[model samples]
Target: MSYPTISFSGGSIDRADYIRTDPAKLEELKDWRARLVKLDGLDPVLTPQNELEWGSLADCPPGADLVFLGLRDGRACFAAVPEAGDAGALQMGSRARAAMGILGHDDLGIYGMARSLVDWHARHRFCAQCGAPTQLAKGGWQRDCGACKAQHFPRVDPVTIMLVEHGGNLLLGRQPRFPAGFYSALAGFVEPGETIEGAVAREVLEEAGVTVRDVSYVASQPWPFPSQLMVGCHAFANETELTVDRTELEDARWFSRAEVVDALTGAQGAAFTPPPPQAIAHQLLKWWLQR
Candidate 1:
């Protein structure tokens, strides 16, 4: 079966380590044809025209916390933190939301990497081992504590988002925060010591009170809204009746194949809608539709 190209999933960049331990390698940064990705807090700095806003290392303002992301087509790629107050022609907003609209597929992939790394750098400024301030190391892929000599790396939280099916219907649910009339595949963070299949089954039972079996992996996407690896799956529901936990979901229901097709295509007269194409849930639903 053919799969749609997921956003933020393709790039041919190589994360070179020549600059990782060698501070000297950073000096040649200005000599390369590099792409710059700037972040302010959790958002990326965008041009007035709404592009990713790339510039030279020399153009970065003073006090920009910079990290070499790697090589794109043999050219250096870097991410920098433009001093908050000096963001002259750039503006900041939700990276997750902005990425989908402003970036191309490959650029979106690079943005995801940058977003996750910068978030780690910002959040881990202080070391947990000895309570000392940590400094960037290994070309921004790691942090080193000066006090106790501990190192920290960026973390990717694993989340299970599964489409549960039984008979000729698929299961979907809605949370209060979701837009009106929209429903999505059930999802939750994978807990410690749990397998992906185990997590999928557990989450399905917990949220909708539907026991699931034959869990199968479908695909994964690097969701960089503060760093999550969404592990998409397809599962078979053992029963159809739902006992939705109100605290977890507002509603959970099974939709037949025809109903799902209408929702996926945004057909008029549809009672509910699936998530957008940018989300993994929408991909899962699309996969189901093709089947």
Candidate 2:
């Protein structure tokens, strides 16, 4: 069976670091050949063909900071980040969430990166250490603080999302925010200094009361909701018993392999709805079923 593309991960863009660092090269690329990704604030404006709508640099508003997204099709690409006073331009992610249902793979990846970087710039306008305003540098790749001489780069948080199995059954959970009957893999952010395996085991045990072992890596996705790296993993638990943490999960239970197959295949009578195809959790379920 063919698998769906993982959203917002596999981008085919060459981020020309050399161009970003060199003043002359970066300046030269800002000509008519350069493409600008149109954005309504931080949200994407998609073409009717479900692709990213490209515009010329002339289209960008004067005084807008242009971030170098990289080279696409051998042409320099960019996204315009508005000045800080234009708070009305920032959508605060509602539009980007809506764009998810419409974006194709490449556009999804590009927009994901654009939205995250733009959002970061909006939020991190000041130096964390010195509480001083920062300036954009290196084509929006870095923010520099003159007061403390500090440099800040974009951050991507690591989260471990895992499928825990015992006796041919897979464990799934639902949080309060999830729609009714929708269940997905248990996941949590990896604490600082924690290993991937440790995060997987700890999240499962804490949320579902399942002490899972035999942690193994499967795949990963760049979830750009404020920039997170989702580390997909699988682990097996010896016990089928669960101790659901009410604060962490609304519910947690094991489903048989057959039920999981029905969920992934979109057949009726699934015990719970699987995550959408673009989600890494959905891919993990498919991977587990195939294995």
Candidate 3:
């Protein structure tokens, strides 16, 4: 029996496709009269900490913006924003710090969007068209420069994470900063002008010196640590010989199914376990094992 890549089950909610393109929904969200509220943690709905009590398209503060991510249940789903300084402060608080490990996908999505938008606003305070400060427009979806009339939108970065398997063993590696015995799948930011498959192959070869074939998409997760979407994949190894790049990996090896099972079950003497359930890496490994 071979070790399997884990799969995400609980957090895998199929966001319906209709939310993005429907004109009515978009119009409703874009309406100036719509009500938008911010929540601290999972509180139902609380007023925003800023002075802009009501949602508006024209007066969002610098370093404050929203990422309009379509609709959830016909109500516009958005990543709300506050000041970047405030975000950092929140992270330093005991509650926020504790939530980092406990937050689910939805919570992480919100946090990511909020933080990234704030960062974007911080950097884009001045318009690209004319070096003048821009104003938030369209419910925080776009920013407009008052001087030259330029608009900017939020961005999402794509990253690839893959589980590589050959024969009955799955490949895993530990980073220099990782705790002893800790290992996860190889991952890297997807370079510009490269497909997901290309990124996976490239990352595998570069980090583990392993040749891969039959690359297959597994799943994707929104990792908002700073606005990244993790594209999970599984690739069959064409060559099993290990030659880890010391600069990237402190250690690398193949783990059998039984070994992985023991680690997951916390049996004595097992190596470090995967990340918490909130992480896609854990899901990927769980999915692989069940299959």
| Window of ten residues with lowest summed lDDT in model 3 | 5-14
Task: Please provide, for model 3 over 1-291, each residue's C-alpha lDDT reduced to its tens digit, 9 standing for 90 to 100.
Answer: 343332222222223345444546656665654334343432222224312122444434454455454444455544445544334421234443345555544544454455455555555667887788888665455688888878787667888999999987899998987767788889998999999999999999999999898999888876544457789899999988988999989988999988888887889998666666666788788878977
Candidate 1 — which pairs collide?
Answer: none
Better of 1 and 3 by TM-score: 1
**What TM-score quantifies how close candidate 2 is to the native fold?**
0.93
Residue 34 deviation, candidate 2, in Å? 0.9
Highest-scoring model, lDDT: 2
- 2 or 3: which has the higher TM-score? 2
Pairs in steric clash, model 2: none
Question: Global lDDT for candidate 3?
Answer: 0.66
Task: Quote the positional error of residue 204 for candidate 2 in Å.
Answer: 1.0
Most TM-score-accurate candidate? 2
Off-target runs (Cα >4 Å) in candidate 1 are 18-21, 30-32, 46-50, 82-98
Instruction: Put down candidate 2 lDDT per residue, 1-291, tens digits, no spaces.
Output: 554358898677898788889878888989989999998877788888877889999999897778898998899998887554224431236677778878888788888888778767877889999999998889889999999999999888899999998889999999998989999999999998899999998899899887888999888988867678889998999788889999999999989999998888889787899998878999989888878
> Distance (Å) between predicted and true CA of 250, model 3?
1.8
Error of 2 at 41 (Å): 2.0
**lDDT tens string, model 1, 1-291?**
877677768666787776677777765764747767665555766777665667777766577677788887777878874333212211234454756876677777777788777766767788988889988887788899989999898888999999999998989999987888999999999999999999999999999999999999999998876678999999999999999999989999988999998988889988697887888888888888888
**Per-residue error (Å), model 3, residue 214:** 0.6
Per-model tally of clashing residue pairs: 0, 0, 10
